[model samples]
Target: MLSITGAVANSNGQKVFKTLKNEELHCSEAEMKAHLANLYEQQKGKCAITGIAMHLHGQDDCDSDMLVSPDRIDSYGHYSIGNVQFVCRFVNFWKMAQDNNRFAELLDRVVANRVADTV
Candidate 1:
């Protein structure tokens, strides 16, 4: 994808947007899995928020449950917190439909619960 940086003058004296620069964030599957493992372990085999066990499938193989749009994600993993949760599929599914406020509320609730449980 291209990113804009500065403005340039056009023939009609109107400012035309131009591409400033571009680079790719390459992440191989193996590296991704490693990162995911770290996140999974950090959360103690459960979601960072919900504290539910993460599931991939019958085989239980999921390196990262990536958000379709990175922009939509929260402030982890650049909105791509890899394997950062262990929620049931249903909860994960719910994430997709939640608005920003609702998502924040859910995460807050889960984190609070986890903290309380620990105490």
Candidate 2:
């Protein structure tokens, strides 16, 4: 048993190598880019509550970790467009460890009663 720490390649090269060569799975830059693009489209390029186009997918702090992850594929969220939403960056990450549909109805709407004002 051993503990790996510090500058990765410098302080724990052997351990890092072992972990890197592990038979587990992982993601590549190309795949990440594609997934982010899909997420951007699914979230509608707008805020779920504001409905404005000020939302973005990847960045630091401002729009960091802003992805709509569906927890249930057969229940609350079916991993489809309907189950997805454009949420705040903080909420996105916080909900990452939880379900999303519970707060899915946070969308804004115009006063439908005034629809006849122009019609």
Best by TM-score: 1
15-58: candidate 2 lDDT, tens digit per residue: 44343322211355565456657866765766553344543446
Against the hidden reference, what TM-scores do the models get? 0.40, 0.32
| List of clashing residue pairs for candidate 2 | none
Which regions of candidate 1 fall more than 4 Å away from where they truly are? 1-26, 54-72, 75-86, 97-101, 106-119
Q: Name the top lDDT candidate.
A: 1
Model 1, residue 32: C-alpha shift (Å): 0.2
Minimum summed lDDT over a 10-residue window in model 2 is located at: 17-26
Tens-digit lDDT string for candidate 1 (3-115): 33233222557666886433233466576567666765675666444555554534446544522112223322332333234444555566763554577698789889999
Candidate no. 2 TM-score:
0.32
